[model samples]
Target: MNRLKLTLIRGLPGSGKSTLAKTLNAVHLEADMYFINKQGEYQFDPKELKKAHLWCQNQCKYYLSEGQNVVIANTFVKHWEMQAYRKLAKLFNAQFSIKVCTGNFQNSHNVDLLLINKMKKNWQP
Candidate 1:
């Protein structure tokens, strides 16, 4: 029997969440991917955050239904922010784990370290 796995990579911007997600051989999903425009550019919109997350969740469900391992990378700073994915894991009967990234790399988003630190301080498991 093939067992499914769901990995959530949580961290603030500039952390290594995305990098770690890429390292895993799973279906990678992230809310930030919604920001990629047809022009192949990242255009973030605060108003679309909910939609982005919803899309990510939908993709996770689709992949898990197909018995594929999934990895989600996002700034899930609060416990509630992770609940949806946790529920999905349970629904799909996938082995679930959360990886918190603490490394402060030069973020591709160019977010300031101060803001990243603030997010880290406020982060909840």
Candidate 2:
């Protein structure tokens, strides 16, 4: 397979992006993981988000070059965020697909608020 295959999976904080990524055996890159590693310890500097993005971009390029699939797990709330990755995939001559996870607004809203409160309680900052 010479062409790259990219899968962009988007969902709110508590949805199953990571789970699906793992199940598919795809290269998983999560924004929250950019902040915290497998142990859930915050290891990245606050100023390093941009660097993280580039690193993830490079990783995607590398895996694609190896003809492997990728699953990018992120909130992807804005069109621009997803656009950047789409551009990257295009630059690499890769195929791309976007999967947006959605649910009832009231349920999603409640889940969002509940997650926010939980994060507040546990957030190191």
Please tell me which predicted candidate would have the highest lDDT against the true structure: 1
User: Per-residue alpha-carbon lDDT of model 2 for 33-106, expressed as tens digits?
Assistant: 66666786767575887777777777777887777878887666556677778886887677899876543233
**lDDT string, candidate 1, 21-105, tens digits:** 9999999999989999999899888899999999999999999999899999999999999999999999988999999998878
- How far off is residue 90 in model 2, in Å? 1.3
List TM-scores for all candidates, in order.
0.93, 0.68
What C-alpha lDDT, on a 0 to 100 scale, does residue 108 get in candidate 2?
Answer: 21
Top-TM-score structure, candidate number: 1
lDDT of 1: 0.92
Cα error, residue 7 of model 2, in Å, equals 0.5
Q: Where does candidate 1 stray beyond 4 Å?
A: 112-114
